[model samples]
Target: MKLRRDGESVYVRPMKLDDAEALYEMRTRNQDFFQTYEPIRQKLVMTLEDYRDRISDDIQHWRDQTGFTFGVFLQETNEFVGRVSLSNIVYGAWKNCTIGYFMDQAHNGKGYTTEAVSLAVDFALTDGQLHRVQAAVMPWNQASVRVVEKVGFRFEGLSKWYLQINGNWEDHNIYAITQEDWNK
Candidate 1:
């Protein structure tokens, strides 16, 4: 589903193919920064076509009820500065999802991500759609740990080899926020 999200200083919405150019520009500009945590996709340096193809798949995932992703844009310029998502959805009594996100390096530390995450979490729990949303942050990623914490995800202890990051086993601290926690 296409979601509309807004906060005091920013706007966020479901991503679209037309966003390829702006998204690519931001990724290219922050190549070195993102490379630290994410495996560098060679196609990122090629053309907007690659971005379009990937985002197209994500958009379809939304339609197919497989996942949800949103692009965070600056209100003043409508520039795509980041993305936040909830994937790995599970139905039944669980009704949970996994959350992940990142902001453009230049936009870091401006509280954009914190606010964006709050909005996304609110949307997730507002209608009782998800019972819980979880995140796994690498210990070294202090910034991400802070973001998830700011959005009410509490530390849930360490998970050895928690994620496959940069194509390797990586340790992480699992964090989670449930509808009950969010309400409180």
Candidate 2:
């Protein structure tokens, strides 16, 4: 619900409209990092007005209980280095949500993403009172695969056409950790 800061390296906080410029900047700079795995949206090429509209929409989604998106900040430089989120939350018998994230290319190998993801997962499983948190990683993304594994998610095999990544159905290996599983 609030943006949280962890020393001079990592910070996790709810996304804000004030974050639009930095977010857009990050996306623009890391175009290649996202182009292959994300939806093909020219939205990143938007002007300030377009960014405002999109940020408004992002805020509304979280307000409406659709999803929770957090900006990952590099506290030393106070830059938005990436984003981490819990989306597609389901209630009732399936109290779960999916974990997703990305880091700035310059910050890729420093273990910041993994550290941020670990914090997010802990928040989801503990503070958020969620039953399970899951992630679907492309098998080729060894770094991402390792991040989830390190955070306690167990490999659950591959799912064909699991997600519509990059505008086409893509196979993704499923990884998940239930609250009980985490406790174990």
TM-score of each: 0.92, 0.89
Native-referenced Cα lDDT, model 1: 0.85
- The per-prediction CA RMSD against the true structure, in angstroms, equals 1.9, 2.1
What is the TM-score (0 to 1) of candidate 1? 0.92
Tens digits of per-residue lDDT for model 2, 64-91: 7667777898777778898898889886
**Candidate 1 residue runs with Cα over 4 Å from true position:** 40-46
**Per-residue alpha-carbon lDDT of candidate 1 for residues 64-149, written as tens digits (9 for 90 to 100):** 76788889998889888999888998878898989888899999999999988887887777642888998988999999999998
State each candidate's clash count: 0, 2
> In candidate 2, residue 131 scores what lDDT?
90
Report the number of the highest-lDDT candidate: 1
- lDDT by candidate, in order shown: 0.85, 0.82
